[model samples]
Target: MGYYQIDCFKIHLTILRILGVWPTENPSPCYIYLSGLFVFIFTVLYVVIYTMNFYFLPQQLEIFAEELIFYFTNVGALSKALAFIFLRDKVKKMLEMLESDMFQSDNPEEIKLIQKAKEKSSFYWKITAGLSVSANTVNVFLPFVVHVVFNVKLEFPVCRYSFIPEQYEAIFLYPAYLYQSIGITSHMLYNVNIDTFLLGVMFLAMAQLDILDRKLRKVTDVCVHTNAPSGSIDKMIDDENAVAEIIKCIKHYDAVSEYCKLIQEAFSEILFVLFSSGSCKICMCLFRFTMPAETKYFVFLTLYTVVMTLQVMVPCWFGSRLIEKSSQITFSVYDCDWTPRCRRFKSNLRLLVERANRPITIRGGKMFLLSLATFTAIMNSSYSFFTLLRHMQSR
Candidate 1:
């Protein structure tokens, strides 16, 4: 629980467990069954409701745009669940890495850096979760509130269906409403938790790299080593402590690299869904903004667009930071008192720098690098799509 010790991640894992995607270590058969069933419900809901709705709905851009806002929930939820199950081996390795001793730190500075990273990751997920909850709340309750206050007929969240006979329509409408609400809410959390977990992994890797950079500098830091041999400063690199510390730094950096590769493997397909579907979701969300609508829908769109943007932005952010942290490792090795160190130490450091020179890169579907530039590109594509849709709507 090295990283799970943080409360945010603790809560995140708990919610994930409830959603059935993360069954925990050596879960009971009952737990697995229940989890599987819970996940299945959303998959079924997506197949039954969204597809049916799409098939039956008119070919109007405005109607499709309105419906698209909710489309991400079920598909994303099911895809993430499948990703976890399909890549359970990778997920297991990730859990092992998260709990491994390499991530543990006794130094206050290193611990602080780790904590700060977790805190930032926590803020990102929490905001996303909160927005998702808020949006769903408005959608579910708006009908009841309007019905009671304004004597208006209660309407379902999205496309109303003929699931019940006309005579029983009034009786079954409320139940249908509750059912859809549950599906959407569960799906929303499912998507949010997976995202938070992935972003958390990236931030954690960056923190470990930063810690390694700090250690690399201190390994050759001669001024701090009072026991340096007299009259030969470069010989300080020959000290056993310096040798041991450098070896530790090497192992630590290697562990971080391994952790990153496994993470990229586990989430490659899921990230593809997130970025590709996420861009269209954002584009439609913005496009939804231009249409005339009720205040509640407008509010939901505002928050949904923010969540969509964050879904794309946060990954690119953590991805870029990960690249930067790894890239700067070489500088960290050279910026220290390494100029006075011996040749063997310099050679070992050079190997480490060479490895660092490649840097860690996490991509979406192995197609686009997850960096801010990529994020900007996705946003530009989205804006262009929005522009195209707006033109169609005007005609």
Candidate 2:
């Protein structure tokens, strides 16, 4: 799992280097100096170009609307880049803690569970990365394809910017295309990297909850005896072992709780920004889809909308799983044969049940819980915004 994570991080760094925004694990004086200069130049160019297209362009409503969607999308990507830069230490700490806390158990069942989690996480990461790359490739090449097939010259660059002088258009046309291609690809990769990394973290939390559930069930099974021997000596020894097992389970549960807290702290801000921007992106994409556009443009919008929906759904799905698994602990305790246990043992069980009753949750900036419910709310809000936009345009 560590190797896989490192490989993914390397891919992220490669993309950043291509964008001239390299972020090394160990920052030397030279690295810092160079990285700062690169980030400043890249960010300034991105913001100025997109901002001009969005706010200053003298274009039709349809054209401006399309540029607005791209503007917000790029803003989201920039937000991710800024977050990666500022929260590098926190992200590093979270990854270290995840490695140390999980995969430490010697129990065969626990080890198996962890392995399954790693496999699942890797699968998800690969699928998302593939989809992002494919979509970006299509977006980059579609303009050229349309231009060639239809033999119609585009009035503006593919991204519809207004800052370039008309006198320089012939000279800078191909150069501008190359620049936009690199800029758009970098934005897509950066956004996907941060989003999928957060998803991996959420999956880790879900895996920890799974381990805790299994451990609790096993402890309950071992400690709860349906039948007892008549001799006091034998029963006393049995009770002592049961108590020891329960104590061990208690420690394991505590560890899982602490791990969940660490995850929440590490990702709350990122999640908040993702969910917030994701809502607007979805709404805008849907609105653009409704508006009459070129065939290729419509296809791109459709794919973009699907990706945005998936981004929101993946986290909510894992978050909902976390809640379900955490809640199961109390029920597992209840399933144990607690009728014949001693008074002290029952009291301990009761306390464990109480603790487990508090369902674990992942929050967005400490604001709202991330769950299927939240996903539903985002969809509803997006539809409402889309309706309002349509009505205003009609008027």
Per-residue accuracy of model 1 over 221-254 as CA lDDT, tens digit each: 5345555564565445355455566777888888
Candidate 2, residues 234-286, lDDT tens digits: the string is 56666776666667667667767776776677677767877887889888888
**lDDT for 6 (candidate 2):** 34
TM-score of each: 0.88, 0.86
lDDT of each structure?
0.78, 0.72
| Collision count for each candidate, in order | 0, 0
Which pairs clash in model 2? none
C-alpha lDDT of candidate 2 relative to the true structure: 0.72
